[model samples]
Target: MPDSISVHFASPAEMLFTDPQGRKLGKDPVHNVEYNEISGGVYYQESIGNPFPESSSQNDESKNIWIPEPVSGQYDIQVIGTGSGDYALDILTYDQTGNSKDITQTGNILSDITQEFELNYSVVSAEQTKLQRIVNIDIKPGSDPNSINCKNRKEVISVA
Candidate 1:
């Protein structure tokens, strides 16, 4: 088998949570989160109404808690909301000189325990420039197309 390079972010360092008013909440503790990785993508077994924890590494001196490290190839990203409403997943990517890109996945939270989604990003650079990427997942105030129903004790997974 090919050597697999995979890391699990089960702690606060891997997740970010927030309220409906855009206020940031610290990461919350969760239970029974199942992670699975395959050749083409990764999958997570998500329950319902499970809120993720926010970033705890923020301070006055060093505001940015999440750092972006770009690895060439394809990446599969996924996030599911355990709440009743939709949420936002904040993502940021930057270069060595501080050039950055911020992307947000809004209203994409899965209200149902059985529903999930994934994102694919291809990074290819012929030049000698390095790339960086950061991602933050949070819940949105409104909008629920899936109608999964977020209550409590929920889970979501992602793999790349």
Candidate 2:
């Protein structure tokens, strides 16, 4: 069996949230926007890929990507500011008994801020960890994270 993990978030104002695979959640998502011919228009569809398909939908209050059998690895969960506002991001764990617990949370955050932290996870018997807080933001052809001050590494995994 695999542990249940989800990365979910919401903001005071509407903005687009994207997962590693480019699936998006938002009101009128211009990035990764998918057309729903049956609805007669387009919408940002939350897509859960790889091991399994998405079984739930993104609601008005929140949006999420559920990893039912998260492999032993690391991936980025991103927030793209189409609109701007303070937001809360949470990692949640669910038990088979129908209860949900928050594993971690980053709240009331503003964009373009940097802070260091560690996030870790396990699947079956494999555990992995990641360190650092990194952000890549795109401004109106103006503000960008100074390349000299930025650092990145390939996602790391550990198992025992």
For residues 1-160, could you state the per-residue lDDT of candidate 1 as single tens digits? 1212222222112232221223222222144343322223232222233344475532211012232233334343333333344444444444444444445544433333322223222233223222223333444434442233233335333222
Off by over 4 Å in 2: 12-30, 34-60, 94-101, 107-120, 124-132, 136-160
What TM-score goes with each of the models? 0.33, 0.43
Estimate, for each residue in 28-56, the C-alpha lDDT of model 2 and write its tens digit.
33344532222111223243343433646
Candidate 2 structure lDDT: 0.41
Error of 1 at 18 (Å): 22
Q: Show where candidate 1 strays beyond 4 Å.
A: 1-31, 34-68, 108-110, 113-160
Candidate 1 lDDT for residue 134: 36
Q: Please report how far candidate 1 places residue 85 from its true position, in Å.
A: 0.4
